[model samples]
Each structure stands twice: as C-alpha cells, then as structure tokens.
Target: MIPLTLGEVARVTGGQVHPGSPGTEDLRVTGPVVTDSREAGPGALYVARRGEVADGHDFVDAAARRGALAALTNRVVEGLPCVVVPEDPDRLSARPDRPPYDAVTRAFAALGREVVDRCAAAGGLRVVGITGSSGKTSTKDLLAQVLPALGPTLAPEASYNSEVGVPLTVCRLTEDTAYLVAEMGASGAGHIAHLTAIAPPQVAVVLNVGSAHLGEFGSRAAIMEAKSELVQGLVPDGLAVLNGDDEALVETMGGRARDVGARVVLVGLGERADLRATEVVTDERGRATFTLTAPGLGAPEPGLRVALQLVGVHHVGNALAVAAVAHEWGMPWEQIAASLAAATPRSRWRMEVTEREDGVTVVNDAYNANPESMRAALQSLAAMRRAEGRTLAVVGGMLELGADSDAEHAGVGALAARLGVDHLLTVGEVARPAATAYQQGGGARVSSVADRHEARALLEEELRAGDVVLLKSSRDSGLRVLGDELAGVTD
Candidate 1:
C-alpha cells in the first residue's frame, strides 16, 4: 500500500491515536494491511474486527509479536500502539443489536477510500469495476492476464468482491500500480453500491444479469438494478462495457451510462453489439475460437481472430468484454488476442479439466453454481464427450433459489438428460428433486446419494477409463472437495 504515517491513517479513518502510542504517530505503515493476525508482518497494521466465530481483538498481541506496527481497534490495547475508533452511543441506542466493532469496519472502509484516492492522484491509477450474476471472477481473471501487458495491474486474488474484500483489495495498491480490477458482487440491492463507493471505477463492465441470487434479490429485475450500480458509480469520463446480448443490460444499463455521462460499449455475439464475436466455434475440449468485430468501437475493418484456452463456449462473451476494455485502452488487437489465447485459468474449481492416469477426464466446476452456470457447465461437459465414453454428471444442490428452487433444479436435471449425459448422480437430500426429474425425463441411469462419500463410492464402482465426468454444485455443498480428490488436487 502507499505508505502512510500513523497520524495520517488516524486522520483518514476518523480514529484517534491512543495515548499508549503517543509520539509514535510518525511511524509509517509500509507493509500490507490485514485482518488476520497470521498475515501481519513488518510495518503491517492489523484490523481488529469482531466476527461471529472469533473476535479479532483477541489477536492483538499475536499481531504485535508478528511484527505489526499497530492495531486499528474499537477498544484501546493496553501496551500495543493503537488507533481507536470508538463506537457511537447514538447508533448503539438506535440499533441495539449492532456490533461494537462496526465502528472499526467503517473506519477501515474510509481508510481504503483514502488510499485509492491518493494512489489515483499520485500515478493516475485506472480502476476497472466488473459485476455480473456469474461471470465476474472469470472476466476479472481474463482482464488480469490481458491488462498486465500494458502496465502494472493488480486484481483481487480470487472472488474478492464484497464490502470488506473490495476495501482490502484497494488497500493493497501502491504508488506505482497503474490499473486495479475490482470484481464487485451483490446479494442485495445496495451491496454493489457500497463496494463502488470504496473504489469508483473509470471503466465498468457488466457481464450479465441472471438468476444467481434470485432468492436474495427476489427477482431478475431487482438483480439488474443492483448490477447497474457499478455503471451509476462510473466517473463522468468513464466507460461502461455491457453485454448487448443480455437485453436487460442493454436496455437498462445503456440508459444508466448515458445518465451518468459515461460512454457505453456493448459486447456480445449479437449484431446489435458495438464489439461482437462472429463465426464462433468451440473445439472438442470446449475452448472457443471467434473472430472479433468492433467497427463501432473504432477497430480496423479486418476482424481479429481470438482463440481462448478457457474451457467453456460461454466464455466467448467474457473474451469479448476483455477485448473491449483492452481496445479502449489503445491495446493493439494482435496483442490482446495473443494475451487472451495464452491466458490460462488462474482461479481454481471453475471448469477445471483434469485427466487421470487411467485416462478418465474430470471437469471440476463445483466452486459455485446457479441455474445459468449449471446449464453452461453441463453443456461444456457434453461438448467434451467422446463417442466411445459415456458422459456422467455428479451434481449437488444449488442454494438460494427461494420458491423456484425445485423447478430450477428440475430444469438442470432435464437439461443434463437432454444433453445426453449417460449417468446422473445427484448428491444430498436437497438435490433429490433433480434425480427424480432426471429419471422422469427418460435418463436411463440415475442415482441419488446422501453425501459426497456415497457419490464417490458410486463413481469408483461405475466410472470407466474412457468416461467423462462433471462435478458441479454450490460451494457449500462440498462437491469441490470430492472433485479435488478425484482430480488428485491437494490443499
């Protein structure tokens, strides 16, 4: 992070330098700011948050022993140098259930905003905010690979797209960092807006509005409103890159960009898009190859061909969004295409294809799942099926679908059967509906297991050397652990 003295940090966060740390106000924090004491190092400032499992205040001494410069806390630490943000009595009375450490969280957010503002003023750092129901992480990974060719780029390590995650990501920036890719996710209406306040983007990309959080947002229309907050937060001279094929995004977010005085560039496979894919085709391995055309966005008349190493045909839209952002930054088409083609998946457990010594192929996409992503993964697995081998799917429950959970799960099962999956194994009681639907949909071989162990045992008994298997479910379903074991991935 950009170095800041304790005095400056205290001022920025609306905290007071405790008397125990008197005369230490000039001490500068030069290391990373971390919430976990285990991650604290020399010059690091440890943020003492109160979590449900354990209180961060309990780790103040541990952080001090690990070379931490100071602790940002709600209560003053007796011996440790500290910046204390006291809880407001008014808020406490207004909300009796509010945690006392909420003050510290608010201070931490303020500190993150200050750091980002300082970095942008110092080196002209460009922030790119990406949000979608499903594709945020994948697109962020693609941009992380492509943006570095132009300048020093820092993106969140994985799916760090929450209120705390966004601020933590911003606090990692340095004076020399040129681009920041902030992946924003939302479970409710105001979630994305809260993240955007911390690191407002010069370029915002909205991939799609889908049913990933249908239960929390209540409806697709509400999800669209939440996703549009990123566009609404764009700077006056900012650019909004949206998926034109998603009619809701084009109709709503396009107007939002205009309202904010930001230019909009639509990307997709449709002819209405300003930057679109043409002649798209996916190989047997499900990797896509497409010609990129963007006459509306000022590309050369000759279309650029892009070949992606990613393992899903749906990624053509992701690649197009990356191409749009890179093109807007004046990156040549050849460089962008080469970077995308050479880029491999950086994050784990999403369309991760692994082959065993016995030649069985496992597509481990069990990181998380919703109806849209589940259908996409199943289709990608079907595309990889060999004539000699059977296509099998081991799936678990998709959580947070509200009243539509059963029907959505049934739709996924029906799609898997229609896609010619030879064997279907549905794990957990929540997923039994899918098993029932698959059987009723004329799937010849189907099984319902109580847990991952039963599913694994069934696979071991029935899986053949040439058979291809897909592991897919929500993160909480524990299917990723089974996928890791099957693919021989450790830790």
Candidate 2:
C-alpha cells in the first residue's frame, strides 16, 4: 500500500480516529494491510475482525508489539492507535461468521480502493481481472508468469478470488507494481461487480462458465450473468477477453463486450478466434503441444509451437488466454510462446503430479472440484501410460452443486468408468452416488470409504508400484493431506 496517514485512512473508511497518544493521526502506514494481527509488521494497519472462535481485538497489543502503525476496529485498545468505525451487521454479513466483521471488510475494501485509485492516477498500474467458473487459478498462474516477463507483477498466492482476497491483492500493489493479475470468483450475483469496484480492471479476461457453482447460482444463465460483470466493469477502451471455444460464453460475453463498447478479443480453438490454437496434441503425460497463430501481431512466422510441461489439455485454453493478453501488450509470438512453455504451476494442489520412489504417480487436484474439473482430471489420469499397471481415482464429495450434486457426481463416476479406471474409491458418503454410478457402468472394482483414513488404508492395500492415483475433492474434504503424504510432499 502507498503511504497513508492514520488521518487519511480514517477519512477514506468513514471512521473516526481513536489515537493511543495525542498526535498519532499523522502516523503513516507504508507497509501491507493485514486482517490477522499475527501478520502485522512495521507500518502495517491491522484489521481487527471478530471471528467465530476468536476476536481480533484481543491481539491489538500483540500487533503493537510487532510495530504495527494502527488498528482498524470498532473498539479501542490501550496500546494501539485505532481507527474506530461503527459496528453494522447488514454490511458485513457476506461471509459465514457474523457483525463487526463486515464493517471491517467494508472499511478495508475502501482503503484498498483508495490505494488502487492512487496508484492508477500516478500511472504504471494495470489491473487485469480474470474470472471463470473453472480454470481461474490455472489461467491466473499462467498470466502471473507471463506478465512478469514484461514487467513487475503481483498475483494472488492460490485461489484467492473472493471479495476479501481481491482487496488483499489490491493492497499489495506498491508504487512500482506495473501489473496486477486479480482472479475474481463469485458464488452469487454481484460479487464480481463489488470486486471490480475495489480494483477496476483495464484488461478483463472471462474464462468459461461451467458447473463449478451450479447450486449457489440456480442456472447456467445466472452464472453467465455473474461472470459477465468483469467485462461490464471495464474502463473505456479497456480490453475484454472471452473464450471462443465455449459456445455459451462466446455468444453471451461477445454481446456483453459489444454492449459496453469495450475492445474484444476472442481466444481459443475456434477458427475465427482473434488468437487461435491449432494442431493441439497431448503427450503421454497429458501435457499439450499446440501451434498458435495470431495475424494481429504482424509477423511472417506462420505459427509458434508451444510445448507445455503442465499436465492436462485444459491448460491449452489457459495458455491461449495468457497469450492474448501478452499479444495485446505487443509481446512477440516467439517470446509469448517461450514464456508460456517455460511456465509451471505456481499454485499448489491443481494437477500437482509427483512420482513416488516406488514409481506410483499421485496427482493432487484436491483444492476444489466441480463436474468439469473432475472430468478433466480423470481424463488426464487416464491419459498417462502404464505398461503393466492400472489407474485409480481416490475421489470425494463436490460441494455446492445444490440439486444437481448427485447427478454431477454420478456423471463423473460414469466418466471414470468409461475411461477404464481400474479401481474407484469414493472417500465419503456424499460421493455414494458416484460409486453407485460406477457400479452401474459395469466398473469392476468400486469401494466407498467412510473417511480419509479408511480410504488411505484401502489404497495402501490395493495400490501397486506402477499404478497412477488421483486425489480430487473440495478444500474442506481433507483428501489433500493423503495425497501430500503419499506423494512425499509432506511427512
């Protein structure tokens, strides 16, 4: 964050100054803005949020001890200079925990907005917002790596694509930051709109809208409406990148871009796409090699061949999206392909493949799941060659599918069965529909375990030296630990 005095923060957040001393309002915050007191440091402003089990107010002294500049809270502490705002429940209730939490978030968002606006006014900050039902994180990782080749860039650590995460990414913008790659996500309508207001994008990339959050959003149309908010929020003459392969997205998002008078770039496998890929071939490990052609970037070179080390053919689309952004910035095709070919997955747990000493391969995609990603991961697992070994899917529940949860799980089960998976292990009861579907599809070996321990035991007894296993579930499912332990990523 750019240097802001306690007085400026209070004014921006519509709060009052509750200084520990007489003249501390002039104290400038020049470092990061953090929510947890433990993350506070010199020149940091600690946002004291009230969680379910703990209150952040209790740690004000701890933050002060760590050289924090001030605290943004509703109540005053003895040792810390505070910016006190009124406690309002309705504004702060977007999350699971309940009142002053939302107030703190609202204030924190305002501070972030101020910082972003200041950076934009001073020049050299280009915010690129990426949103999709799936592949947001993967595309973000690609863009993060590609952008830094041009200039200094800041992207979220993992799938930090929520309201709070967006603000945190925005606040990380220093004066020297030239690019901001923000991954925006939404459960319902208007979430991305709010995120865009915090740090508006000059370049907005809308990936495909799939069944990732079908339950929260009742229908595909509604999900499209929510994801379109990114392109709608673009500044005048801003660029809107849409996926040409997804028929729904191509039609809906193309119309949205035209409606807003924003410059549009369609990127995918489509023949008429602005930046298109052709002759896409996936290797034995499910890595892709594709020929990219863009007439917009004038070069006599017919095409650039990009060989990706990342697993899965789905990443071909992600690479094209990143390539479109780089091309818009005038990066040559050879350079874009080079940077992309050299890029690896920076975010953990999504197609993170580790080959154990025993020659077993563990693909940990347990970060999050939906029907689309589940199918993709399963396909990638099946694509890997095993001479005398088999493929196993250690699957679990996919949450927030609403009424379609069972059917989606069943569809994934059918897909696994059709892909010729040797064994199907469902971790929890929520995944029973998938197990049942697998059996219905004439799958030979199918087992349903009550917990991760039971699932691990089953795998230990059944897995062989040359077999390939996939651990895929939502974040709360805790299947990632088993993958980490088995793959030697953790003890």
Candidate 3:
C-alpha cells in the first residue's frame, strides 16, 4: 500500500472501521511480525489468522505491543473487530457436491473479488502472476533478478503464493514497484482464481502443471484447472505464456487463453513453441550452453547462450520462461542474456555446496522436495562426478501430498537407485517407504536414520574424500539445519 486512508480500508474490504486517529490517513494492517515483525512497519493492521495448533489471536496482545494498530481474527478479541467466516475453511471439496463447502468457496470467491478490487485501486503496479506444476519459484527467482534491469520491481520474498501470502506481497507493493511476480499454487480449483483476484496480472505465465496437490484435488485435470486460474484474471489484451511442453497445459490453457482476451505464447524445448530453446548443452559442472529460437518469428531468432547462478538442467526451462516474459516486455536479447548470466541465486538451500574439514562436499537442497525437484537435484549431483569417492543422498518425506505419499516417495527412491547414489540416508516416518524402494531397486548402502540427529551422527563418522552429499525435504521438516551443520562440520 502506498498509503491509504482509514476510510479506504473500510471501502475496500467492506468491513466496519473504527477510526484509529481522529485525522489519520495512515492505514494499518495486522499480520505475523515476530522473528520477522521488523518487516512490517508501525500502523500495520495484523490479521491474527489461526495456524495448525495455536490461534494467532492469542498473540494479538503481543502483536499489538509490537506496533499492530488493529487485528483481524475469527474470534472477537476484547478490543478488536472480528471478521468471521463459515467455520470450515477446507470444506469445499473440489468434489463440489460437498454442500456448504460450495457456500464456503463462494465466500472465498467474494473475498477474492474484494481483494482484487482493493489491489487494482492501488494503481500502477504491473503484476506478473506465475503458476506451474514445478519451477514456479525458480522462474520467479529469475524474473525478479531480470526485471530490475528494466525497472524497480518486487517479487514476493519467499513462498508468498497462497491466499495469505499473496495479500501480504500486495501490501508490500509500493508505488516504486514496476512489476510484481505473483506465484500461484492450487490444491483445488478456484485457488488460482482467488489468487488472481488479488493481484490481477496484466501479464502472466504458467510454467507447467503437475500433480502436486493430487491428494486434495483428486486428479491431474483438477490440478490443471486449479493452476489455470492465473490466466483467468489476465486482461484480454494481455499475454498468457504457457509451457508448450506440457500437454495438459496446452489443452486447458489454450482456449482459456482466448477466453481471457489474452494472446497465447508458448515456450519449451519443443520446436513448435513461439518462444523456444534449443541445442542446450551442459558440462560436468552443470553449467549450461544453449541457443534459443523463436522459429516462426523469423529474422534468425536470437542466438542466446548463458550460464546461470542456479545449477541444474531444470533451470534451463525456468530461464526460458523468464526470457519469454522479458521478450514480451520489449527487453533486448543482450540485456536478457546479460541478466540471465549475471543472476546470482538468492536461494540458501537449493543446490548449495559446502566443504567439511575432511574435504567432503555437501549439496544442500533441503528447502523443499517434490518428484521433479528431487530428480533435478539428483541429476546435478550425478553430473558433479565425485572422482575419488561417492554421492550420498539424504532424503526426507515431502509433506502436504495428503495421500499417495508412499508411491511418490518410492518413485524418487527408485530414481536414486538408478542414478547410482552410493549411500542413501532417509529421514522421518516415511523413510521406510522410500528406503525400501531404493533397496528393492538395488541401491546399496541404504541407511534409514531415526531422525536428523541420528543422520547427523551417522554421517559425521563415514563421509570421505570427494563425496557429494545432498540433503532435501519439505520445509516443515527442518532440513536446512543439516546444511548449516555440514558447512564447517567435524567428526
């Protein structure tokens, strides 16, 4: 928010407003600001939204102490106005026949409409909403890094892609931001629609769709429907970029691209895409070399080549997505090339390598795990080529799949078996599921650790020279600590 009057807040959210100061124009927003509260300034109207175990409303008093002028919560605090919705937030089964779940979904849709209307009035922020089955974050990372060359812009700081995260990112959009790259993920249909309402993108991209939330959405078609929500909000004259490589993306998004009044552009290794990459090459170091092509566009389609701060082949697709977007914005091929080459990764966990006292190398990619990212990270390790020793993979259970977790885990485990990782360290309750798959698939030296503590203790004693170890898990699993511990670790 550039700055809104108290009346503006009421007008946007349709909420009752109590005047904070008699003549105040400073609008307040309340949300979590504890270890990270410094990010929010004074006059923030915090939303004490509930979490898994504890109610954020309980911290309302403490949050108020830290400069929240007002708090939005489900339950009424002694001195705050409560914005209550139906009790069930997760009621809306994509199944749709779930009764009041439909009603709840309608309420969220209405809320999303209000959010979109509110953000649209903020003015002049050109938003770029991004969604994918995978690589949304990496593509966002590349977009944020490149856009600065065009003008000052802010992509959401972290996993700011959900309902709560999208709103906060919008709140941070000052008049200074020329572009806002919004990442949208969907567990069900209408999620992308809700996300798009808040940050109605003039330009948007769909990286690709995958079955990330299948446990909730039930099928890949449902997942595609959910992710396609970003394009639904695009202006008719805007551009909708799709991954031509993904068949479902092409099928669902193609006609919807027409429906939104946006022009469809495609990007992929495929020869058909309007913005495509070809002739890509990578060395043992995971440094890529490639020429990009936009065949139908004529005029010898720019011969672009570059190295990236991000290590892994998957990033080529991420870079190509960013390049296509930059091209749409009239950026020169040279600047795009320069930005891609100059972009140093901000990720602390993804493909980070550190050395131990015994000269062992650890590749820390533990910020998150999915089948696609797991395969990419493993391939990066494989290409690293530990000359004297071996590649050790430490994998943990990916969270939030809801069900079918065993099969997905097993798939990654089997891939590890095929990739020839010498030692496998599995963490968490799902360790047995993956380790069994790996061992069954002929992966030797498998060790299913009791926990990170056990894995750390076990790893300290056995790691040898020239070894490349990768640690990965879902964010909830607290795997980054392993990466930090290994950086200067001693046995």
Tens digit per residue, CA lDDT, model 2, 1-491: 88999999999999888864667888889877887778889999998877779888899999988889889998777788889888775665565222223677778879889989888777668888999878999999999889998888999977888867888888888878888999999987778888888888888998788887898889989899889999988988889899988878878888887787788888899886888889998887779999988777563357889999899988988999898888877787789999999999787889999988888888999988888889989999988858888899999999888899999999989998999998999999888899999999988799999999998888888878889999999878888888897788863
Ranking by TM-score: 1, 2, 3
Winner on lDDT (2 vs 3)? 2
TM-score versus the correct structure, for each prediction: 0.96, 0.95, 0.87
lDDT score for candidate 3 against the true structure: 0.71
lDDT digits (tens) for residues 1-491 of candidate 1: 88988889899888888763457888899999999999999999999988879989999999999999998999988657888988876643433223232787778888999999999999998999999888889999999999999899999988999777888899999888899999999887667777788899999999988898899779998889888999999999899999999887789999999899999998998888998899988887889899888887667677888889999988999998999889888899778888989999889999999989987999999999999899999999889988788899999999988888999999988988899899999999877888888988999799999999988998988888888899999999999999998989997
Better of 1 and 3 by lDDT: 1
Model 2 regions more than 4 Å off: 88-101, 296-301
Query: Taking the tens digit of each residue's C-alpha lDDT, what string does model 3 give over 1-491?
Result: 44544455444544444434454324544343221223434666555555557566677666556666554444456554333333444653344422323322233334444544545565555678899867777788889999988877878777778766676666665546677788887666666776776678887898877656667777777777777777878976888888888876887888887897888888888866887777777775565666766656441546766777677777888888788788877788778878998886775677777776687888888887776777888788877766688888899878766677888889888988999988888998874677988999999779987688898999989888888888988777767787778775333
Candidate 2: deviation at residue 430, Å? 0.9
Higher lDDT: candidate 1 or 2? 1
Task: Report lDDT per candidate.
Answer: 0.88, 0.86, 0.71
Best by the TM-score measure: 1
